[model samples]
Every structure is written in structure tokens, then in C-alpha cells.
Target: MPHADTLTVVHHDDTKTRYTDVRYQLIRDGIRIWSREGEHSLTDILMTHAYRRREQKH
Candidate 1:
């Protein structure tokens, strides 16, 4: 597992359409490990993380 402090999440949005282009990022040791774009529901957050983690293993 990554360090506790390394698993940080940041929402990067530069416009009023943050909801439209919801870019949520997962960072580890100052590097972006996973991210997703576009409007997404709160429930999708968990699914997105799991999907990215699985993809990273490959």
C-alpha cells in the first residue's frame, strides 16, 4: 500500500464547468496515479479508483 500521506486526492478544475469536466486525481508520492474526466456521480468515485488500480497492475 502507498504511504498514508501519499494517497492524496485533488480535484483540478479551472472553469465554472468543473461539474462538467470533473477531473478527480489520485496522487501518490507527488505523482498522479489515477484520474478521470467528465461529470461523475459520487458513487462512481469508488468504482473509478478500483478500475484504475486494476489497470495499473497490468
Candidate 2:
């Protein structure tokens, strides 16, 4: 999971139709775990923890 200190930037197109992209940067002890583009959901964020665990095994 992203630390509470994580910084996230959400960008939208001029049309305001939908979220065009999202940028996430981890600002604490660990490397950035997930920085995805395009639309996303709460589930996606939650799933990042699983991904992080997988990454740590490498």
C-alpha cells in the first residue's frame, strides 16, 4: 500500500469528459510501487499492495 505521505496527481482533459491520467509518487521510505496512467478505481489501488508484495520477492 502507498504510504499516507504519497503524492498523487490526477489530470483531466480540456473536455472534462473523464480522467485522462493519474500520476502517483511515493514520498517515503520505499520506491514508488505503482504509477499508472489512464482511468483507475479503488480496487486498483487496493490491488497495488499485492503487486508490491510480488515485487518485493524479486
Candidate 3:
């Protein structure tokens, strides 16, 4: 499980279309800490998390 304050990935779409882009949002403490739009795979969420985790050490 993820810590409520440190990790979360919201996979959602903003539009209805054949090419509708998905969004990956990194949330912490009820606010968005990072976001990426126009991705094709839900896997982007995990990739974002991995990347963010490294940066969080700073």
C-alpha cells in the first residue's frame, strides 16, 4: 500500500474519443504534486512514480 501523504496515482481521462489521452496525476496531501497528460498507457503512472521517488530525495 502507498502512504496517503507520499504516493498516489490517479489514472483518468478528460475526454471521450478514440484517441483520448489519459492523465497521470501524482497527489500528496490532497493536492497535485505532479501531472502528465496525453499519455497512451496507464503504465506512465508507475513510471512517473519511479521518477518522482528519486527526485523526492532532494
Best-performing candidate as measured by TM-score: 2
- Tell me the deviation in Å of residue 56 in model 1: 32
Model 1 gets an lDDT of: 0.28
How many Å off is the CA of 5 in candidate 3?
6.6
The residue-by-residue lDDT of candidate 3 on 1-58, one tens digit each, is: 1222233344444322221222334344222332234233333232232222233554
What digit string (tens of lDDT, one per residue) describes model 2 on residues 1-58? 4332234332232221122223334443322333345323332231121112133555
TM-score of each: 0.15, 0.16, 0.16
Q: Which residue pairs of candidate 2 clash?
A: none
Clashing pairs in model 3? none
Report the number of backbone clashes for model 1: 0
CA RMSD, predictions in order: 12.1, 11.7, 11.5
User: Best-fitting candidate, measured by lDDT?
Assistant: 3
Q: For residues 7-54, write the lDDT of model 1, one tens digit per residue.
A: 223323421111222234443323323224432333212222221233
- Which residue segments of model 2 deviate by more than 4 Å? 4-6, 14-58
What clash count does candidate 3 reach? 0
Better of 2 and 3 by lDDT: 3
